[model samples]
Target: MDYIAENTNFKLKNSAVTLGKFDGLHLGHQLLLEQVISLKKQGYTAVMFSFSYHPGNLFSKKEFELIYTEEEKLAKLRNTKMDVLVSYPFTKETSNMEPEDFIKDVLIGKLDAKIIVVGQDFRFGHKRRGDVKLLQSLAETYGYRVIACEKRKYKDSIISSSEIRKELKEGNMETVNEMLGQPYSILGEVRHGRKLGRTLGLPTTNIIPVSGKLLPPCGVYASKTIVDGISYPGVTNIGFKPTVGAEKVKGVETYIFDFNQDLYGKFIEVELYTYERPELKFNSIEELKQKMQEDIAFTRNYFLKLNEGNNSSYSN
Candidate 1:
């Protein structure tokens, strides 16, 4: 797989290119990617053209908390048949380019796009001046095919990254996970903490967050902790501890319910299955421990029911 920055030195001929931030690789993005990948059977290169940073974040006051960072995005796409991954630098020059020039230069001239796949709502080039109509009109001149994938829906609701983010922010983990086509997860290295969970008698492995990553919510969750390819049931807390003195940083602390082993400095992944409760400020350490005990009870029952349901469904 080729990783090109700015523009490729060599023209990528007969490429099937799709453009977007592809933040979460949600169902909508996956639908478009399927179209891109399908073109590979006809000998076209599968190329994903996305900017290094989301364009919205550059102009808007709110920074985009990405579901998948650059590394995570690339890692997620690794198993797919994508041929080239280009992170075009989003700058004033690129943003100001006219729609025609973007098609003529970046898409046709620079990337050598043979087939372009995008959503009907696709916009590009200078204040979102380009749309599907413009690309369709120029397809004859550019000598390429245009595939416009319609909006995808799940359970009669339109699926989008923003919608998923909304669900995540509200701590609707089940719905968010369903939209993502898999478990919504964070990948990071285990880091040292204050060993406070140890004091509570539930020693935990602390996980550092990926820079600018979108966390599900600041709370406890029923989760799975994956370390070295082995998964363990876990109860995770994500937030700055208000009870144990204020800390500026937010972190993930997971107590593995299945196994115990030294995991400091190990790169691990945690998948939040369900939101349990919000972070609370307790008056005393004992009070905090009491709530944590209830949280564990809820966490254990959640997984047990999940397991029983799966077994029942399988037996049926």
Candidate 2:
């Protein structure tokens, strides 16, 4: 997808667009994006209009966890086959625009949106005065169509970014994976640490994640780490190393099985598949080693069961 960072630099032809924060790119966001893709098949160009920051962040002092980086968001947009991605900078000034001005000046005049797909509860402009009903009225006056995507329900509850955030905050890996259609991931560069795991016979790669990214609750998890575009089954610990007396400082440590290479300064992506166990404070080095062994065994058995299920499905 073509990413246009500045609205002033965005010069695209008329297109059908979906507008949202798209924080988690959850199922509800996916539904809206699919509509934009479908519009593209009908000869309208598919575009996505998104804000660099959360809409609420402009109004509140409270900080929020982001589900994806700007790069990750663009990648997800590309996967939806969006022709253009218009990333508008969210600011106090931009937040103060009137609803009609946003539609006429920004949406119609700048983006040249032939149609807009938004959620039912979608609102914009000063004090969020713009709603679906207002958008429908604006569409009639501006000579464009409006598509309001309904809420996506999973197990009698609406799938939302907030719900996904809650699941992540609570360390509900299974629910998070189910709602996201994939494992929750964290991307960072490998950094040299004290090599405590190595001294304990389980060498690990340490990473410091970018700030503001949501992480799973502190625990050991079954994960897959990607290095140089290749994935390896691994076990990860997200905690302060309570066993090693480093419990006060948070850290992310991963030990990729059957793989050994210098990874310091290399960027890696770790995807958490399942939570194996919580961080524990062992009484001694031997106790910690035994627990580590158990953790690895559990991870191995989990992958074995996963592979078996996959093979069975294919063979049947």
Number of the top candidate by lDDT?
Answer: 1
Where model 1 places Cα greater than 4 Å from the true spot, the runs are 6-10, 311-316
TM-score for each of the candidates: 0.90, 0.90
lDDT of 2 by residue, 73-168 (tens): 775566567788888988878889999999988888888888999999998889889999998976778988998988988788888888988999
lDDT tens digits by residue: candidate 1, 213-250: 98877999998877777778878989988998866888
lDDT of 2 at 24: 77
Weakest lDDT window of 10 consecutive positions for candidate 1: 307-316
RMSD of 1: 2.9
lDDT value for candidate 1? Answer: 0.85
Instruction: Give residue 115's lDDT in candidate 1 (0 to 100).
Output: 91
Give candidate 1's TM-score.
0.90
lDDT of each: 0.85, 0.82
Cα deviation at 266, candidate 2, in Å, is 2.4
**Candidate 2 error regions (>4 Å):** 6-9, 78-80, 245-249, 310-316
